[model samples]
Each structure stands twice: as structure tokens, then as C-alpha cells.
Target: MTSSAIIQNIPCTLVTGFLGAGKTTIINQLLATKPADVRWALLINEFGRIGIDGALLKGRQNDVEKPNTIAIREVSGGCICCTSQLPLQIALTRLLSEHRPQRLIIEPTGLAHPHELVKQLSAPHWQTSLSMQSVITVLSGLQWQQEKYRSHEGFQAHVQAADVVIINRYEQLDATCQQDLLTWIGTLNAQASIIWAAPNDASSELTVAQLSMQLNQPSASISKQRATQSSQSRISLTLPNHLLTNMPNAGNSAAMTMDDEPPYRYHDEQQGMLLAGWRLPSHWMFAADELQQWLLQLPNWQRIKGVVHTSDGWQQLNFTPDSLTITTTSAQIDSRIEVILLANTDNSHINSKVSKNERQPLIDWDVYDHELMALLAK
Candidate 1:
């Protein structure tokens, strides 16, 4: 291909990880440092129907001096590689054609099937126009401690397929655990560039020049190594109803669709995991002290994240086994929260009366729901 042809084709990168693994944090950091001249687009697929990630990323374009430098799209409520392939294709093709970004970054829902997803991204139809880049999977050093992360196929596939694994919160690991992590990486034989970065460091940013290389370039196999769905299946796409539209369910239930309503809620379960999320109206502010108290008391959930319009301001909250933080955000949108818990809980709830051996839903949804709703400002 000619140099001009190569330049015209947008380079794409897939950032995949497990729940609460810091994928969104690292992507935000990359956008914060993006070059002033490069045009970019970001497609975010989240497990929840609420589109919380998209809302968090909405203010990112303002971080750049150039307007419209970063265009955002969402295909929430399902995994892009399997059930949501058509939406992923539609959103992606539109991102490339309309925005004409120089580079594209996709943050597939953490629960996505990475290997199959990559195979879809690297398929034959995209060979000429889209240059794939390194698959970067952000991982918390603590993930290894959990048997769930070690045994889960989706989590394993993410790390195994990555060309770069940014082990965030690496500082927390001791000499032995650090070595163990390295050994596990070696066992995978993924040949990925391991970036040991502290979660707070600015050094983990992914650069445009780094992602724009030709897939055939010696080091750029990061591109040659990825995959995708068939493009021949009518990919006409417009992103009108982006939230809670295609979210998945654990069993046979259909996904719910929320009108332009406040306080929308959704829950789903699959692969022994449960995802619950809420989207509250902007006016539904909460007291910071009460919020913190309530959140701190609910520790059984595997992960929790949201940006709420609190009395203090718009605050972003993230909680995982590895870290917890509540910081301010400028993203002006509705308040939202996403909580994920392992479904195999043995009476994980604080108020649970289930016998020690009897399994129950990770949390008593009715109870927590009432508590959180009570915290909201009337």
C-alpha cells in the first residue's frame, strides 16, 4: 500500500480488562495527554445499560484545546464480541467514517470475551482501512490474589491476548507477589510488553504516534494480531438511544429500555457475576458524608463506580479490592453508579440470615436499594 493509503487508514487499539481493573482510568489518562493535532475517537462498551462510562468520558474532549478532537460512542448493556457484535460494528464503522479520527481506542466491557472479540476485530474485511494496534489490558496487581480472576475465562483471555499489560497499582505488590505476577505472565507466553505502573503515575499514557504505526511494521503486530466481526452485514448506524438499550440479562429476561426518565436502574447476571447500576437525575444530589458512610458499609460487592452530583460537587467514586477513591469530576451529566458482585455469595449481605453454607445473591438488592435511595436528597 502507498504511504498515503496507510495514513488514510485509522489505527485502532483495544483496551480490555476485568471488572475494576482501571481500564477507564488509563484511557482517561491517555486522552489527557493526547497530541494537540491528532483526531481521535473512543468507543466504550459497558456491561450496564446506564452508560456510566460514556458519561464519565463526555467531558474529556474539553481536556483538549481542539474541539471535537475526541468523539465518543457507546454500545452499553452487552459484550461487543458476542451478543452486541452488530452494535459494536455499527458504532465502530460510524466512528471511523464520520469522525475520521487518526486513531481509535475501544474500551470493551471488562466482561467481554477478549479472544473472540479480537478475532472479530482482526477479520478480513478491515485489512485495508483499519490498522489495528496493541491490545492493552489494564490489570490491578491485586487481581491475582482472587481465585475468581485466576479461574475466570474472560479475565484469562484478556491478559493472554494483550500485547501490553499495564499492571496498575504495582507499587502495592511485594517482592514475592511481583515475581509471581511476572511468572504468571511468562506462563501465558503472551509476549506482551509489561508496563509496571503505579495507578497514580502519569507515565502510563498511550500515545498517538505509538498507536498509529502500520500493522505490518515489525513491532506493530499489535495490529496484525487483533480481529473483528463481518462488515457485510448492513452496518448503517446512528447513536440516538445509547443507554440501557441493549444491556444483557443473566437468565432469560429481556433487557429493559428506560425512557427519558430519572433514576433508571438495571441488573443482570451471567458467568457467576452480577452487575447492577443506577442512573439518577442531575438534580438528585446527595450529602457527601452520608454517601461515604453508606458506601463504606457495603463492602461485599466486587466493584463499585459512579459519579454523583453530591453536595460537595460532582464526585467520581471507584471501589475495588485493590483501591478506593472519591474525586471531583467536571463531567456534567446525571449521577450514576455501577456495582458488580460475584453471584455465588454465601450470604454476602450484611443483613443476611442465610445459613453459612447456603448461597444467596451477593447483596440483598431490596435492602441496599432502599438505603441508597434514602441517601438521595429529597
Candidate 2:
């Protein structure tokens, strides 16, 4: 019998994107607007040893009613598409066998390469149980247009592999920048459906099979410019996931495990090294202001995330790529500061790394609160 004849299973939507491309934001928006008749589960990947992303997503479970409204599984240490394909299969099998949700949404890490991922899903084992319905790539228009991202081999792979590309943060770009992006998109995949997004019109969905596939050669100057920009801006930071989730002061909590039966191990054949992660409770939250203050003190901090118990509720703060945002529900007043830090050449704890000008404490909390309330009032 053919592989498709073996399982004859359901279809799954794979949501892939580059770093800082708003994948989580789009996923959340999709779940929020889901018709009451459809059931779905969300699988998330983390590059760190800790699974804070999975924990934060769990909070969404409380907001929906469908038994399969949302189920979160974590793929850690590496990305699901490139470095952890087996886990992806296991997660899908378990979700299907257990929850049997009507749909499965796979959210790969920012660094994940979607083309490699989709190719894996075409394997006989997976083809039987799941159909690769669509590849949804969420992109930040401003960031996508940056000289650094548009030229990367990985970025090219990401854009070329998409069935639908959701252009987010569209309002952040100027008219010229937006037009350039649209033109660039046409060159990348003319058949792919492109959707412009803003907060007011954040909810958008596309059926993958209905889209087009197109690819064009990128200019050499564009590639060189991207390389220069990326080298100057890229930063890396590594931490034991345990520090983010298991700390005594941790707040938001949840339990997470690898769906893989044996729990795959990480090893580097060339370097003869093995990498492993410690499991931390799913609960932890952070205070927005305190977290920002802490980052200012870390000379080498690149990307950081941690669970913190805020006065209002639970939250997780992710700090990386020059920005820190708290992922929390607006319903509760949860406020606390926690994060994971990733560093590059800037990863120094020396006095020279610290600017002599000194700095004032961050008091953006009260200011931000007032601004938020004022906007809400308006």
C-alpha cells in the first residue's frame, strides 16, 4: 500500500518565519478568531533548554472551550524543521492519537528553515497521517525589507517556501518601504497570497492549497548588503533553560515534556559534544519595568526570557534582537520582569563594556500605563 494509503490522516498547517517576524502574534490572532466549529492545537519550538514559550501559550487554553481549542507541545534545544524533525513527527502523532483535533498548527522557531521542514512532512510516515496543507510565513514588513534579512540564504529559503505570507507591522513602514516590500514579495513568490496587517485587521487566514508558488533570483548587491548588515546586528546568547523556569522566584507555571517516546538527545559529532536541557515548571511571570531595568545592567545580554509572578497574574518576558516584550493577557494586571539573555561580541561583563555616562532608572511603567489607559479611553 502507498504511504498515503497507510495512515490516511488529517492535515496540519505549518507557520514558519524568521526571527522577530511576529509568528506568535499571528498564531494568537488566528486562534482568537477561530470559528466555534473548528478545533485546533498549537505546537511551539524553542531554541533554549527551557520551554517558556510553551508555558505562555498555555494561558490561552483557559480562554477557549473546544476540547482541542489549543494544545501546546515544546520542541527545544533546536528547531523542529532543521534540527528536530523526529520530535515534530512524534508531537503530531500524539496530538492526533490523543486530542484528534480538527487542525494542528505548527509554529517553528525564528531560526527554523521551513523548506527543510515541509520536505520532512512529505516523508511516507508523516504523509500517511498528516497532509501538509499550507506553509504560512509571518513577516514584519520593516524588518523583512531590511538589508540584513532580505539577502540571507535562510531568509531566502523562508520566503521561497511559503504558500501564504502574512505581512505584519505594515503600519510601521513608510509608503516607499511598503511598496518596496510588495515588489520584493512579487519577485519572491508571485503566486503566494500577501495580506497586510495592523492591529485593527490582525485576524487573517488563508487555505494553503489555494495559493501560488513562485521564486526569482535575488540581486548580488542585495545579498552583499544583507551580509554586512547581518554581521553587524546579529547576537547570540545561551543559557540553561532551568534558570528561566525553575528559579525559586518563578511565577507562571505549567508542565511540559517532549512528545518523542525516548526523548531525543542532542550531540555534535564533529565536536564530540552533547547538549541537554533541564525541565522547568511551566509557571513563571515577569514585571515589565523591572525586567527592562535588569537588561540595562547586562553588558552582554542578547536574548532573555523568564517566568515571573507579577502583582496581577503570570507572564513571560522575552528579550532579544534589541527589544523586550511581555507576553501576557490584557485581562489581568500581571506585571513582573524576567527574561533570557543571548549575547554576541557585546557579551562582555567588563567595565569598558559599560558606558561611563551612567543612566537613569527606567520609569516607563507608569508612563506606559497612563498612555494605555488614555488610548483605551479614547
Candidate 3:
């Protein structure tokens, strides 16, 4: 196909949400249920250096009846909306050129701002190259009730920029909570279609045609009262060096050390909080009990999610300030974990230490790394 034909025919869907909102789960479901004849390409972006989501999706692909038709690429360490833009463009162009997929799906890091991404995709250069479809934003009703996340600029931006808003984990909400969520979402995006789906529900399949139809309908008008809110509330927090650096023997051994001047940290700032990540080798298996104990003691982190190999099998870890849930999951290509911490602007401890060459001393990397290495050594 000619380049012009490829751009006009391909439909790209952007899936975005805040941390732990089940974005990966939804994407996996969509991929599993996709038509057997259609070729799909997925570009997943993560806030952490380790590509845990990509691994999980690949695992899901293995279970599908026809896995060969799908192609996956991962962009990690920073939000693609800013720091990872060039990488995204290069990867996307390559995926399109190589696969010639009928559809494209992009899952940006939870910390990303969707407006910037939409702007980039809709630029004049890509106008003839790609047709933008419905932008889906997934939300957790329980998290929506939390003042901390509800007030965050990045969360609000996701709501505002979406053409469709999905409320996952809807089964956990009561009638009043559901109504409150709908009301709040309506306030942010009047035009976007809203759908409620249970977490990991196989029936919730998103397709290119469905998204395209939704885009064609008239949307509700967004209120201008908060037009300036995003700009005013957005704060760009610098990611620590440890999160951007890659381990020397990444997937080869159970443990490894980092090198100096790994990848220069991406400086583009967004509207979200901070992230700290670790990439461990596939051979390292965590003792479930020990990992849980360590996670429980981490009171400073707001959200944590990752896939790790355990003595029993593969395990998935999902943690928040108030809860910790672990379940048996399939093994991934490697073990990786990322924790979302309080923003630098909000925490006095982080704010006081912000400097040009230094990262905020929110968490001690040396001690944390040592503890993780010791845990794996056990």
C-alpha cells in the first residue's frame, strides 16, 4: 500500500488513565477478542523503566487463538506525551511500515497528559498518515472518590481529553457512588460517551469500528469554566536517576547493578506525580510473604503494581496506601515494579531537596536496592 493509503486507512486508538486503573487489563481483553483477520499493533508506554505491561500483554497474546497477527512494542521510563515523544514517533512509524496493521492501539503511561499526545498525533505531519479514533480514558470509581486523585491535574486532563470514559471496577461502587462518578465525569467531558465495566471482564471489547462510530457522533460541550485549570495545576516533577537507568544484566541474572550516565533523563514535564521503578532479571523469584511484608511497610507510596515470579508461580502485586492485593498471574518476560510516590511539590521532604544535578531524596535508592537484592538472594 502507498504511504497515503496506509495513513488514511489505519485507525489509531489512544487508551489512557491514572495509575492502577486497569488500563492493561482492558487492553488485553480487547486484544484477545479482536477479529482473527485484522492485524493489530500495540504501542505501550510505561512510567517506569521496566516494560511490565508489555510483558503482561505478550503473555495474554500467547493464550489467544491467533497470536501471530498482533505486534507489540514498549516505550518505558517516562511519559510518551513529553520525554518519550521521539521514541514514540520512531517506534510508531516502524510499526506501521513493518506490520501494515489495520488498527493501532496506544496505551500511554498513567502519568501522561492526553492533550499533549492528542496534539502530537493530530499535527499536520500525521494528518495524512494516521486517522485518530476515539480516545478512551479508564477510571476507577473508588479512586475517583479519593480527593488526592480527583484533584490531580493529570487525572482531570485525562477526563477532559477523552472521547470515551470507561469506569472500571464499577462493581465495587454503590448506587450513590456511581451517580457521583457520572456527575463528575459529565462535568469534565460532556461530549464523551461513558461506559461501566467490571475489572477483567471479557465482554468489554473495544474495536476500531466502535470507536470510529463514537467519534462521529456529536459530543457534549465541555465547560470553559476550568479552561485555565490544567495549566495552573500542572506541575512537572523530575524523575530520579535510578528510574531512568537500566540494569547492566537486565534480563540475564537475578540481580545486577546500574551504570553511570545510562540514558540522560528526559526533562519534559507533565501534570502528574513521581515514579520509581526497578527491573529485575527473569531468574529472580520473590518469596510472596517477604514481598508482602516489605510492601506493607512502604507507607509513602500512593500506588504500586508489577508482575513478579514467585516460588508458587507468577504473582501480580497491586498496592495502594490503604490496600495491598496479590494474585497468581502468568509469568512475564522479566520481573519489574514501579511505585507512584507523592508529588515533589506536595511533600516538604521532596521540595526542600530539589536541585539541578540532584533528585529529591524521597526514597533512599541505595538502601531500597540493597533490600531488594537481599530479598532475591534469600
Candidate achieving the largest TM-score: 1
Model 2 ranges with Cα > 4 A deviation: 1-7, 62-68, 199-290, 296-304, 310-313, 318-324, 327-344, 350-378
TM-score preference between candidates 1 and 3, better one: 1
Candidate with maximal lDDT: 1
Worst 10 residues of 1 by lDDT: 230-239
Q: What digit string (tens of lDDT, one per residue) describes model 3 on residues 147-209?
A: 987988878989999878878766777899888888888898787888766445455445434
lDDT of 2: 0.52
Question: Candidate order by TM-score, highest to lowest?
Answer: 1, 3, 2
For candidate 3, what is the lDDT? 0.65
lDDT leaderboard ranking:
1, 3, 2
**Candidate 2 residue lDDT tens string, 259-368:** 42111122211011112222222232334465456445654333455555444445556655536666554432222222222222232232233345533111212232
Give the better candidate number (1 or 3) by lDDT: 1
Error of 1 at 22 (Å): 2.1
**C-alpha TM-score for every candidate:** 0.78, 0.63, 0.75
| Backbone clashes in model 3, listed as residue pairs | 7-129, 191-220
